[model samples]
Target: MTTRTLTPETSNTFTSTIGGYTVRGRAHSLSAWFVLSLRLMMGWAFAYSGLTKLLAAEPFSAGGYLTHVAAANGNPLAGTFAWMGSTPWFVEFANVAVLWGELFIGLGLLVGAFVRLAAFFGAFMMLMFYFGNWSIEHGVINGDFAYMLVFLAVAAFGAGRILGLDTYIENYEVGGRTLVERYPALEYVLG
Candidate 1:
């Protein structure tokens, strides 16, 4: 996660062009191929999950899933799940959020559009899933933990800069000032 000035002789650097405006930046140790692979893997996993759920019976219903959580024996969060299930509005909202959130995050990651932002939200959603799905019957650490870590890694490493649209957007200039230069705080999400 080092930022070095783009030099003509810089190795491992990438050049991006949009609307005849070309910009160059150092891709650093993160190889474009590697990031693309991770993007596809993580993106497909999420997208597939959402698609299957959408195609499944009662795609928008959280009742069955929440009821299962509530009925699961020895689940510490059973009461909370039951309460959530009792409220139709909350369950409906959660159902829609989960459905669209997964779809958007997956597409964003795959296309390398708004990658850092997507990873941030992806990590947040994963955290929620981890907590909500926690069960005594299953081990404490699960795939959600691994997925969350991957999302965080993608965000921290600026994986989108290698092979994604972010590479161009990151260096996009308006009035001779790039977004990152204009707003230093945007470095976190823009990267």
Candidate 2:
């Protein structure tokens, strides 16, 4: 990644009010590099996790984890998780969804295609994990929560536009109009 020297024109300054408090922040042009780094890092991490599970000698199964691990430890969603685990069809669906969902989300982020969609789903998975792990010893906040926030930030910042395929895809001519222009709803999924 290349870092660009920050100039007055390149710097982004903004102000917002939340909960009756005024907030102000400035982002250096180099912030794009950091966002891109985050995208790549998360993409690699998720991809590696899914790939390892796929390659494992034993078939991936969430039944035991959901029924025992997730239901235990005072989890607020214990009943729901246990029910899902006990349901044979739901367990089967979860196994496939978890394995393939991670792989697809990772690939989408890595290639910067449909980044918003990927980040949305990634955040959702992390949210599920945050509740599933259910560790409050240190605090309610944990790695899963942090990762969920990062995923949200990635989508909010439109990180895929930073030297990503989304830029080209967004501009590709479709029936004489750019894809984004042709289908406005695509903005929700693409960068």
Query: Against the true structure, whose TM-score is highest?
Result: 2
Q: Compared with the true structure, what per-residue lDDT tens digits does model 2 show for residues 18-137? A: 899998788887999999999988888888888888999999998898898776789999998999889999999989989988988898899998999999999999998998899999
List lDDT for all candidates, in order: 0.78, 0.90
Q: lDDT tens digits, residues 73-93, model 1? A: 565777887877778898898
Which one is best on lDDT? 2
Candidate 2 segments exceeding 4 Å error? 1-11, 14-24
Query: For model 2, which pairs clash?
Result: none
List the candidates' TM-scores in order. 0.74, 0.90
TM-score of candidate 1 to 2 decimals: 0.74
